[model samples]
Target chain A: MSHIIKPILYSYWRSSCSWRVRIALNLKEIPYDIKPVSLIKSGGEQHSNEFRDINPMEQVPAMHIDGVTLVESLSIMYYLEETRPQRPLLPPDFIKRAKVREICEVIASGIQPLQNLTVLIHVGEEKKNEWAKHWINRGFRAVEKLLSSSAGKYCVGDEITLADCCLIPQVFNARRFHVDLRPFPIILRIDRELENHPCFRSAHPSNQPDCPPEAIK
Target chain B: MSHIIKPILYSYWRSSCSWRVRIALNLKEIPYDIKPVSLIKSGGEQHSNEFRDINPMEQVPAMHIDGVTLVESLSIMYYLEETRPQRPLLPPDFIKRAKVREICEVIASGIQPLQNLTVLIHVGEEKKNEWAKHWINRGFRAVEKLLSSSAGKYCVGDEITLADCCLIPQVFNARRFHVDLRPFPIILRIDRELENHPCFRSAHPSNQPDCPPEAIK
Candidate 1:
């Protein structure tokens, strides 16, 4: 077994995607130090030379575990699951594992990337928020269908798998964009259930170390 | 093992992302039928009511395997890996599997979504190709750095993994967009090697059932 050293998570408070990882880390009871990377101020601190050295993509939620540095929230979460293994986030069976991963992929690949702040910037300021709402709503609708088939109290058969970790953050972003949740009853139910979980509530954007007061207001 | 029924892949010939799954299916020796969903002509068949029934997102490359339906290329690929374990596309060890998935995510999540045709449509026609080239180059550069640390004969190790499956299609798209590949030597080398492989060549857009004559020109 690898030595238990507290991992360091480099993240931004308002980044709902980063909030997902924080919840995951807490759920696994894995202690980690936080290094908040301000995404909005100074034209994105993640773009700085030093931060880019840690993550070439210059994205937040980069994790340093043991001696190795990991980038991408999904990758970091998977690594923790593998290295830790006690509190398993993925199912044991291969088929179930694939299903869990599928739900996660739908959010991580199909949804989150399109609605990211950087991509919104490229879409132009006038339509940025609208673009975010459009993609987030589109993604949530599809997620609603998948949840209709696969979800059970959580994204995949009731356990707090990696899919849930990916889902809550996206829902948070959706609400921020003012997407109507009435259309997605399944997603709303899942999000409501997840919100009450201690790990998830503690890691909410409003509770983060770097969350801006104005944004909350 | 379950009965080996012929799989059906609903995809478009020119869709670079769909082409990734095509290569994987071929590499795994899985025989399947190709059902074309033309992205052009009458503003995309993917948006039609019929296709939307199969895929709520109305996206290409949705697979029908052994009576189960799967969407998202990464998810479908993982499903294939699970159902057909003989030809493993992922490493056996946990960390190695996570690394291969990380590389795949960087392309699938980070690169491919940004330059998707739908996203480009919003950017306007004149800037569409430019948008594709910029994001492809950005993604390729990141792949170059990742491959520098992890690659050998392939993206992860000597054998072909999911990372290689993703790289070939993205490289093809980059070349199509006229993004200079000379700067990414390692990525180019890997592409050259995979390009020569029978599975990849067979799955090339030019060889698909619905490939347009002009695509080869």
Candidate 2:
């Protein structure tokens, strides 16, 4: 029931949010096409009128699937889970489900928004980078505390829930910003484990259709 | 079982995130104690070593319950739901639960973090207010679109899920920033409706123990 019309994702290679959706789609084994919204060059293509038609907020990582357009990377991922529940991204139990949401919320809500490129641009380049590092470190420290109790092989119990999917991309961004992750050994350990997984590996920035040659590193 | 021991919430009146937890506690009819962590004066009391011992992040809105100390407002809320499942803040079905989570995620992950006072401060005073308004508008717009389809009496399925608990504080922040919410009729409608409700009304910043009288309005 899931394989009919191909999905189209408006994305950018270096975008952590877009990277999250890409990973979710790949993990679900859902086929999709990519439409790159270059963040650099020409003052951000996402602000263009054509892109705004797809997403009023003019953000990257908007998804068009089954004649429906969904923005917000988390929403797109959830929509995919709803439309394609075969390979579930969430847990089965109510408590576990809430826990997964909590973990994702910590990264998605509590951390990512504080450190995104757009927010950094508004804050000024030097302070923006510092803000990103400060919040990312704060978030990672909290995640380390959480993982200390909750992690086994992945972020939740043993399985890879949406929490891990959200974590990797955020940690990727934190590393790119030169935020030292040494204080978050548990988080770093879980990230190391997931980085090698086929689903996560396939969704790496280098693997994205529009990734630049220099971005592969 | 519910009346055994009242929850203890370490919070501040003007903190929008703290307001969120306060509303959730009130809505659940969970009686609790409030320990104020003033964000201003005394150079932001949350930075004290004493408070930092309670929450490593030194953030307000931490909850201590059943011998567990929980940081992160969303995590604390979820913890309450787990500990007291009688009046569920989540949906009954997996799909519905995911949908509720999607709404919460949009505001929590997409909007709230961007406009947080701490983040604004990092951006500095010159552009701080502008930064707050920009992210608030961006988040509210996405919320408006998402709520337009799902709302009946609330953000999803006419029930007061965690989404509403999240929505009220965000709307309050938006109004505080003068985001011109007229464009978001659905959000405004729900905001108006919730604003009058006892749970939201009582949790207003003005009503909090720490909020100054002059700052209440």
TM-score of chain A of each: 0.95, 0.96
The best candidate by TM-score is 1
Fraction of native Cα contacts kept in each candidate? 0.56, 0.40
lDDT of each residue in A1-217, candidate 1, tens digit only? 3446778899898786688789889889888889999998899998899998887777887888767777778888888887788778998876667768777877887888888888878778998888888888787877888778888888888788888988998888888889989999988898888888999988888777788888674
Per-residue CA lDDT of candidate 2, range B1-217, in tens?
4357777889889787788888888878888999888887687888888887676666777877765567778767777777678678888765566557667777777787777766677668888778788888887777787777668898888788899998988888888888898888998888888888998899998898888889867
**lDDT tens string, model 2, A1-217?**
3358899999998888888888888889988899899988699998888887777666778877776676777777767776689789888765566667667777877788877777778768667777788888988877777777678889888988888989999989998889988888888888888888888888888888788888677
Off by over 4 Å in 1: A213-217
Q: How well does candidate 1 score on lDDT at residue A170?
A: 89
Return the lDDT, model 2, position A191.
88
For all predictions in the order shown, the interface RMSD in Å is 1.7, 3.7
Residue B39 Cα positional deviation in candidate 1, in Å, after optimal superposition: 1.9
Question: Alpha carbon lDDT of residue A112, candidate 1?
Answer: 89
Model 1 Cα shift for residue B35 (angstroms): 1.9
Q: Report, for every candidate in turn, its global Cα lDDT versus the true structure.
A: 0.84, 0.80
